[model samples]
Target: MLFNASQQWEKCVKQIEERDRLIFVSVYVLIFVAGLILNLIALVVFFFHTKTRSHTTVYMTNLAFADLCLVCTLPVRICYHLGVSLHQRLCEAMGMILLINMYGSIFLLSCTSVDRCVAVCFPMSSRVREVRKKAPFICLGVWIMTVGASLPIYFIKPQLPGYQNQSKCFGSFPVYGTRPVAITSSLTVGFGVPLLAMLVSSWGLLRAIKRSQAAQTDLVDSRKIQRMIAMCLVIFLCCFLPYHLSLLLVYLHQRSIPCSLTSSYNYSLMVACLNAMLDPLAYYFTTETFRKKVDLDALRQMWPMQSQSQSADHHSRGPLNT
Candidate 1:
């Protein structure tokens, strides 16, 4: 058994082939073009075309920005897949930028979920106001922390034994060393934590609806939020989840890394890039959120017209104040 295992471990590392290259280039190009157009439109609409800049708007804008940054990294990856010679340092930078912004997008969306939960749970609390005021700071902190965490990737030496073209970043990470650890950490902190946070937010929203007297009026609110939450889950499962899981598998396999595993990881990663394309749905959901607050600024307009309508009806039919 030990001899067989050793033989397996000694199998030759998979090299990039025509099918792998074709799939990689095709998917990456689609993600790049689609993500670029989508994110740019999101940014434009979120920034210049609208007013009423509430915190949820802030979150969605930051999300769009993060997605744009991630989209920018795809061209470099596509270049690598197309057999263009790239410096190892450039490869490292591209990887780190993608890692940083991917987490940035995840964290920002988690913030949106948490913010929505807080707003729902404490509709009129002063703390909610405070949290809204701190939105920019929270986004700042997410960017800082994501960049800091990914800074270590820059320190990872480009060279690994038996690989001469360091630019062939696909084969760069060793199976047993720091790569698996990084993959595990990202799977935990990057994807797992955010997923749990979104679920908790969903639960909080459900609980708040149950406890409120105005659930009928807030049904739209609940539905919109539920749809957004479902979209987030879909993005995670289709994009981040499989990519990270396959990535961990490829990085941890002690035996010869199979072409199939590498292919799976590559394809899933391209799917992950589609999160940018899907993020516009979040903007649509949150755009109508908390809009009932201010009259004008970039994004936010409101779900609470029912409350105001009921109040107006009571005032109009009951009496004209002296």
Candidate 2:
């Protein structure tokens, strides 16, 4: 029982997986390649560059690390799909890594949103800057809390009756079965609070941006903050929302989740995992030095030079800075 789906669907579940294995393999492989490259580049820019100064850097660096760890789990998932030999301990470890990093990424993104919201709302508040100065300590607390939340990994098991086979790496969490209260409580604590925090903070940022525009105030970091908010909102809504909603539906069913819902739940998880790749885009938005340091812009120089030269022929060069 992978969630509330029981053993009865195991045969049908296997059939569903087999039928759509190509799509599954393709998606995971694409995610693995893209997420790996993006997160690695982010790590290089964040850690290998100068000492961290901004709270955004601290949160994004942790987010990148979490994403890196999350993408590493895909190869194991791919192998499992391909019917390759996998040990029990390796499977359990994969599950552990997946859960830890997944929640870690979510919380870290929320932290970034909150940080930006505070900065915009309290632009001159020294107290806010002081809190930003203590970013590393804050990040450490987030990590510890994320790990503690992931402690229920032991509760996951295959939900099939008489299912003693150790072939599968993961199973349905029993909390989804006959325990709607437990599921709702945990779900609310684990994902609900972060969702609310992100929403409130992002709303604060959006309104500030609107007010600034209404007054024609040229805020220095307004564009950067806009990009950051866009990335965070899209990832949370497009990726994470579906999965949590699916979990809620499964549990609220109060019985074995239907085969149709089971498949949808699995797909929602795939959507959630996509934030690993998308998180790196947020780094580009929230951090200034990351843009300066990343080698990707080297390619941009090649394309823009000819345009810069052609425009110089017709018009006097002026400050290109926007």
Candidate 3:
């Protein structure tokens, strides 16, 4: 009986390891490539090709920048999995950076949704200019808040028992212990609140759009509102939901639940990375000026000449669009 029980335990462990290997090799590879490419293109277009400097532009640009920062942290993760040497401090730092950008993206996404909701529901409000002017300040606050939230990593010593040489800095968290508090806090602030804000804003936007359509709004503007609502739903459902569900499973696992759900957590994290890739699609759909036709490749190819020409054009056209 004892011999048979040992065999069964070993089989279960082997299956988990095998499943995790497949997830890391397949899903993470797709995330790394697609996320990097899409985010880079978005940053380039937002930084260079776009002529408008509106509030939406500011929010989207910062969101893209945050996604790009998160994407930059993936190579370090891949290297750690591939047996590359990483100092403990470096590992901890990378973990903190990942959390910072993850929460930063969450807050920025919420801000964008709120901005759209206000714009649609109260377009003629006297405070429109005041709200628009606060966007940069709001972005700065998000950065500071996220950075402060991530600072606990500097003080918490990672406890990786038996596998001291392994680079599982964030992976070795004790589910039922202090780690759960951190994870719960992160999920609550980073995922839960933002998701609620998005849903409320999306519903508000939908009502506004419906009223406008009833009043015979422009076809173009109606389409933009519909697209924006769809994008927010996709981001919440496809990207954020799976990861947070996995975290819940981790909590259960910590409580001695004999489930094998932990092996799938990394796959959900990869799915979360898809949001970094998909956000540019949201930008393309939501904003009128962002959808304006511009040759990004041509602009990059002729950057030096184009910079001079655009400078002349800026002056000729009389001030940057704001």
Candidate 4:
């Protein structure tokens, strides 16, 4: 009976290992391909389209740029997962870039939500436009804050436990213990505060829109803004909430959980990767300019052929004058 129980345990371990390997590979590949494609489209459209070059688009463009930076780091992760020797220096570089992009995107998204809320709530004041004029400066400030928040990782060296001759890299706060104060400080400032700001701004915008005596055009715009806010909130809840929750859980469970529960850790990693895919969809659905650009591009593609067919039909007819 003891021998049979041992065999069952071994089988379960093997199965979990195999499942984790497959999930890791799939998550990375999907995130790399999908993130690159969608963000590239967003970047190009926002860059070239005159109509999309608005205050909102400025924020979105920055967001796309950050996401692109994040996607660019995936190949290094792919290499690491495939058992390639990741040098400590390379890991540090990758970690810095990842943190910069991740926090930058989050901060910019919160800013975007705030900008939209102000616009919807006070269209008459022109204060929103004034703020929009300074968006570039605001974005620069956000970048600085994000980079500063991520600086602790560059300073603290993190080692991989139970892996012989493995590379050590930058560490999260609880993982490295070099800057627990800094890490906690950053998590609250960088993530928690921004999340709260976004929530409050969006809620205010929704309430303002609901109360306004809207024209037909204003009503349409309000609905669109509402949808955008909803999408942003959903993205926040789905993508970011899990990763933070997992961080809290891991910190709490460090001593209680067994080392054999590696699957849970890997699953948390997979959930984080889902954000890369979900972000593009949020941008596509929420941003009116993105949809308009897509629609215009489609029309432009069809217009020439449509005009040529009409001309051909006209030429085929006998002369009306004769």
Candidate 5:
């Protein structure tokens, strides 16, 4: 009887493992394709549309650049998951690159939100131009900060257990009797501080927009600005907040939780992959330039026929038609 029960448990575990493997493969592929395509389009559009290049465009450009960097790191992760043979050192390097890009992108998005808020609140200030001019410096600072924050991962050696004859790259930290201070510190600095900043900046943007609306001046522009701000805030909240919260919880769990909780943590990590794909859609739908580009592309498609019809109409008319 005990043998039969054990067999049944083993069968259940196998089924669960198979399901998780399938889920991971499907989600990662979708994230890779969608993230790469959308961000590429964003980069192209932002780069070519000179008229669209404003202070906000500068922020969006930096955000897109950061997201592109993040997408570049996905294939390594996909390969790792697919049972590819990778050294532990390689894994740590890939993990560090991923961390830097992810946190950097989030920070840039927060900066974008703050920039929009300032633009909305103080439209006439000369500081708007200053903000636009200094964007390059801000972007440089974001990159430096992200890289600096992620530097510690390079020093640790991560090992993959349970994989036979395969080296796995993961973040190695000193385990102090079930306590992981290094991991906790990394999460706090990378995800926690950035998330808090995003929330605060988003809140300030929302409040400023509300105040402007109540003032009954620049109503149309204010409405448009409000829509844009709301869309950005929604994307940040829906796509990112849960991911960071999950990381925080996982960090706390690692200190005193059972290994069984890792399945839930992995699920949360997977959900975070959705953000990269969703961000491009948010920009496309909210930004006026994208709409105008779409409109022009649609118009160009009809222009040849419209021109031919007009020419025929002119030929058919008498001289008096002039």
Candidate 6:
């Protein structure tokens, strides 16, 4: 009987290794390379290259920083997948940084949407414009809060004694042996609330845009508003929904279900990290000033003489007016 049990355990371990190790390594490598490059570009462009300090720029700067922080954690994760053992404290710290930045990205992305919604809905309100100046402080608060919230997870260690290999890092962390509460709370706070906020802001933005269009309010840039709403909706659907659903499946698996979502969970997580790459696209496509600055910089670099000659001509061109 003992021999049979050991054989079954070895089979289970082999199956898991065969199913996930390659996938994890491949996905992490892709995300790490892509996300690292994209977020670094975004950080440089948004932080130092651009001259604008508008509300959109503020939130996007925060978002870029958040994504950069998250992408930095990928190497550690990839090292773990490649069979490099890490100290428990280092693993926990990496996990905390990942969660903190992931949630920070979610919040800042939502903030950018809200900023657009308010600007559109209250186009003539000086008060709304006044509140826009508070964006930096708001972004600071978000970073602090997310970091604080994720810190507790560092203390919630895994208890998978026999499955020691799986218990390291984020694979089987904050294990829900009997207490489902922790996972539920994390799901609600980390995923559900952010998603709901994005949906609400998007809906409100759409309504405001329509109303302003009907009233012929020229104060709001209808195109910009549409772009913000579209980006938020796409990120929520593509990056967030699948990962959180996989989390739900994982939770259900912990409750003794016969479902095998381990691969699903890992792949969905990779999908989530793709947001770090996709965000630069959002900045390029949706944020007009950022796009213009990037284009002008590219032109300047590619043709220094022509850019210097046309600098005065291009100086007065508004964002996306071209």
Best prediction by lDDT: 2
Q: For candidate 6, write residues 290-318 as lDDT tens digits.
A: 23432332323234455566666755434
lDDT of 5 by residue, 1-322 (tens): 2223223333443444556666776788888899899998888887885544566677777777777777777787777666566677676677677667777777787777666545544433566657657877898998998898677546543343432243434312212112356456545765667667666766765565454323244323445655666676677666666655655564555434433444444555566667778788876546653233222222222244543445534333211000
Candidate 6 wrongly placed segments (more than 4 Å) = 1-14, 158-167, 173-181, 213-228, 257-259, 289-322
Candidate 1 off by > 4 Å: 1-16, 158-165, 174-181, 210-224, 289-322
What TM-score, over all chains together, does every model reach? 0.78, 0.79, 0.76, 0.74, 0.71, 0.75
lDDT measured at residue 33 in model 4 versus the true structure, 0 to 100: 93
Candidate 1, overall lDDT?
0.67
Best by TM-score: 2
lDDT by residue for model 1 over 65-120, one digit each (tens)? 99989989989888887878778777778877887888898898788878877765
Per-residue alpha-carbon lDDT of candidate 2 for residues 201-238, written as tens digits (9 for 90 to 100): 98986775555532233323455556667766877889
- For residues 1-322, could you state the per-residue lDDT of candidate 4 as single tens digits? 2223223333444455455655666688889999999998888877775443567777878888888888888788777655566776787788788768877878888887787666555543456568777888899998888787677657754443433243433212235222356546545876698899999998986775565443123223556656767887887767666666555554555444333433454465556556666776876446653233222222222245543545534334221000
Off by over 4 Å in 3: 1-17, 158-170, 174-184, 213-218, 221-224, 257-259, 289-322
Give candidate 6's whole-model lDDT. 0.66
The true-structure Cα RMSD of candidate 1 reads 6.7
Better of 1 and 3 by lDDT: 1
Ranking by lDDT: 2, 1, 6, 3, 4, 5
**Predicted candidate 4, C-alpha RMSD:** 12.7
User: What is the lDDT of every predicted structure here?
Assistant: 0.67, 0.68, 0.64, 0.62, 0.59, 0.66
- For candidate 3, give the lDDT: 0.64
Model 4: lDDT to the true structure: 0.62
Against the true structure, candidate 1 reaches a TM-score of: 0.78
What TM-score number comes out for model 2? 0.79
